[model samples]
Target: MTVRVSRVRQHSVWASLVSDDAQALRGWLLQLGFAEDLLIPGERVDAIHHCQLDWPEGGRILLSSTGERPTPCRPGTASLHVVTADPDAVLARATSLDARVVREIVDQTDYPSRDFTVADPDGNHWTFATFAG
Candidate 1:
């Protein structure tokens, strides 16, 4: 039998990242100003383990350290875009953490916003912007 439902409640969006060193990645995220309170911490059960950084608006970035080694995102492959009030301020914090800048802050002609991109320790691309989304 085919089950059908009318109307669904969209709850949250979760982004997961597999890291070779979850601890160091968590530290780097902390340096970028993601407070410890946002983290739910990790739990290991058998051969699986996972943790998450809860976003204020219901989204989350799940940081997992298990399974085979992960292959970092290739250039131009993918990027995580974060909308914030102040992109410059975020840039400063990232600078302090010595994160690699993939792109300097600039106003996009077409996008109608200011943003910057940086590569995390594991080579994942993250873009912080003032875009209202």
Candidate 2:
């Protein structure tokens, strides 16, 4: 039987990021609760990993090569913006998982946003915040 594909239903985002070390980075992801990740066929720089804990809501990551030089994550390419009812609780979990504290949750006087940043195993940024300032 032949397989057919269509976009009428839905799709998930597979984000590609620059990585210098694949296994080391993936290990970090697993440690951060993204367990049982994987690397697809034919790759030299990095591997693709998945964390389906939230399934339809959470997305997977694709680790790509950056030659021999180190590269920072592409601005908006790899980010998971999550809205939480309790920002403090989320921040607690993130900090416990060794997430990078990009910004502390504070009352935004200008934009009405309260959020923080947490870096994943591969150093990809995942911002967990809410619009309620």
**Model 1, position 6: C-alpha lDDT score:** 48
The positional error of residue 52 in candidate 2, measured at the CA in angstroms, is 9.2
Instruction: Give the TM-score of each candidate.
Output: 0.71, 0.49
| Per-prediction CA RMSD (Å) | 8.6, 10.2
Clashes of 2: 0
After TM-score superposition, the amount by which residue 51's alpha carbon in candidate 2 deviates from its true location, in angstroms, is 10
Displacement of the residue 12 alpha carbon in candidate 2, Å: 2.9
> Model 1: per-residue lDDT, tens digit, 22-106?
6787788767866544444345432214566654433467665645335462322346777667889889999999999999999
Clashing pairs in 1: none
- Candidate of highest TM-score: 1
lDDT of each: 0.68, 0.55
